[model samples]
Target: MKGSRRAVVLGLVLTLAGCRKGKEEAPAPLPPTPAEAPAPGAPPSQQQALPPDMRRALSSIAPLVESVKAAVVNVEVRDAAPSHQDTPWNGEGPDSPFGEESPFGAPFDGPREDAPRQGLGSGFVVDARGLVLTNNHVVEGATRIRVQFPDGKEMDAKVLGRDPLTDVAVLKLQGDVKGLPVVRLGDSDAMRVGDWVVAIGNPFGLASSVSLGIVSAKARDIQAGPFDDFLQTDAAINPGNSGGPLFNLHGEVVGINTAIAGQGSGIGFAVPSSLVKELLPQLEKQGSVTRGWLGVAVQELTPDLGSALGVPTGKGAVVTEVNEGTPAAEAGLKPDDVIVSAGGHPIASGHALTRTIALEAPGSTLPLTLYREGKKQEVVVTLGTRPDLEGVASREPSPEQEESPQQRVGLSLSDMDSRLARAQGLPRAGALVTEVVPGSNAERAGLVPGMVVVEAAGETVRRASDLARVVRDAPPGDALLLRVAVPGGGRVLRALTVPKQ
Candidate 1:
């Protein structure tokens, strides 16, 4: 009897599930009939009736999709048979910038290690002479590439240039390619959130699939790379949809579908066309990108740090470190200096400064406005080529230090001894923090036990006494600013409120 009851319940559940799926896939309602239309020559009312064709044209996006679908192409790539050392292509590997469980619509791979691996992606023609644009990852290790047009025509193609930094690649189709339909690149800067967008691609080898969605957000940093300003959307971008074009309502390519949150998440990312356009000329000419480098590490200038430094809060990037012999050091830029502007553009944040400098060519002299010792100063520095950071591992934080005797502002401090300095890979010229009292101002200020206080109240702290002296001399009820070297290699500013005696 129990088994019979269980079977009945299972059948009921399946019936309900089928009903929901049927409702979801049901066809849309038909257009209004002639009897439902307003009579001819009737007095005009607020609700004016329209012909069925006019209503369909107003309500449907079929025309727009038809107009732009021709330029979309399917990109198929085949890799040479894998060697004994190579792992089979499961869409997760060192070649992919996105790590395990990659956000990109990773190409579908064949299922064998020794077999030639085949992958499918999407691309669009941007020039009548058969120049095409797609994502670099789509064709990164392929030994052969072929582009399949909507009309079932396939043509061999070669990589003209590729910028791995931007994940963009340009391909030139071979064999009499004049008069190919092309899509116009649009101004991504003008695209606002919530604007409607259409994505066309071959998802899962289903050719010529179109999905409609709105721009969910913009300038999203998914930690994909240093220049991660992805346009987030709710479009259904799937595997095999990589390198597809994202079109605006005006039939212009605003972005390139590159990554997705996960399968069936309805969240995807696209590279803005603005950044693509900026890199296209260089990629076409040099086949690689060269970014300008200013050899200074900067951090955000918070309100309390700004108050202690006598600069406007949230206005500039604070120099944390100036590498030796670099452009910043050569220009005499010191730690604690606040960079307010660069190249005539206001520097609102550290990211802004980095992006502004990177956009300029190497060897270009850039004028900078900075605040040092509560005074404004101007300097010019020549930028250098940015170093390749690929494959460089980040330093992990140091282990917690042993507790010390001296305590202030809820911190136990000690002068950096030779042994401690060597262990932490730091110079012996700073006061080392050994412990942080829970709920204390120092702990609240983000002071960890392994940090070294390098500067306090704009004065160098070579020992704990130096920090104590600076704190003692500081005004009562004011925030004490300290520049601290973190356990790894970066510096950060902390503002601690002096405890009331």
Candidate 2:
């Protein structure tokens, strides 16, 4: 019995030993302590993101901010008449809503008052010898102008020139201003809509206030002036932000802060740097902006109208009228011609064409493509100086009038005869718009009751019948372009979409 038991135990031991030998032996049981002594201490409490690619490249704007802070400045001005100033600062008296909403317009002959009205805005140094750039209204009609640097050094500034047409101006520091930093200019045309931007300005006398945002839009027309293409940004620009530098991510000036919405939060407009580049030299050389003009009234094309013209909508401007002896007329451009492209760039709208011509140098030949009568043709026009932009119609609206039906668009019109025109202080011609029916085509086109409708369907409208006839002639589902004169000396082009049904 003892022998059998010993033999069984021995066989079991052999089996256990063979199994242990076949197994690869567990990793030597990790060590009794950490392999590298726990990294010497408690491992870093905080560490940067791993792999380097996980971090944003521009985490610090300090270096850029420091480099540009010197170029920006606070503009202070004193005006003789407080109430009558074209641009008042922030919210002032009853005129608060009107301040900074528009450019400093053509001056009126008014007596200068002794009331000392102090204003604050912003500007930037452009020349190392002390030349500065700012909005014209920032220093317009200033009894005295001063510039204060970020370093707290204040110097008197003299307006080198002013161009209210472009609302741009150049200034020279009257006193010693050495070692002032100048900011680099960037291509406004190259900036994308989502690109980051920064604004540095003096808001409400707070000098050098910085705000960050993105480019919200470009080529925005706020109806402030004839040349109203403005870059819109949501960069916290405020009342005193006018004439400040709008910087791109590259630390370059891409725009100049000019205006904020009369009723909005963060909605601000800046004159683009491309325009600044074009206007600066002219403003510095001549005290104004000299633009190339073609002497043609234009309106944007709609899809239905584009179909009628055989061109794509939003691709060009249609010639409503060409003034005799103007470059456009000289070039044989006729009414209804579609300017598809001009000056080597695609025309996006009437505003785009207007901007193209205005930017081209006077006397330069501009190559243009016109889609006429369902075919495309090319024309070359030697540009002419844009005459002083006309303010809205000189005629004012008088109260006396008779209403007649404009059935196509639901507008009430009146004949501008000698009796009615003289009564309303308007010319004895054209159709005066007396009423626009709510929710009608005319109303949808923004045809106000007091405006003067001078043109309809691209033809001069002389009487109620003229407008009615033009409206009646247009085929159903067609669009009509109306040139109306706003009461505030402004002209606007409106489109009435005639319903197909």
Worst 10 residues of 1 by lDDT: 3-12
lDDT of 2 by residue, 1-501 (tens): 000000000000001111244457633323323433445445476433233221233455555566687788888764333343333322234433335433322222222233233467788888888888887666665555678888888888877776665567788897567788888667889978867788887776677777877789999876655677778888877667778888886677888887666567777778888988988887777756778999999999888888988875557899999999999989999999999899779997898898889998899999999898878899999999887555311221122332223434556777765665555566567777877655456778888776777888779987778987777667756888888765554678988876432
**Superposition TM-score, candidate 1 onto the true structure:** 0.62
Candidate 1 C-alpha error for residue 453, in Å: 73
TM-score of each: 0.62, 0.62
Q: Please, what are the lDDT tens digits per residue for candidate 1 over residues 122-210?
A: 88998898888888767665555779899988888877877666678899898889778888898888989977788888877788888
Off by over 4 Å in 1: 1-58, 81-100, 106-108, 391-501
Error of 2 at 106 (Å): 18
lDDT of each: 0.71, 0.68
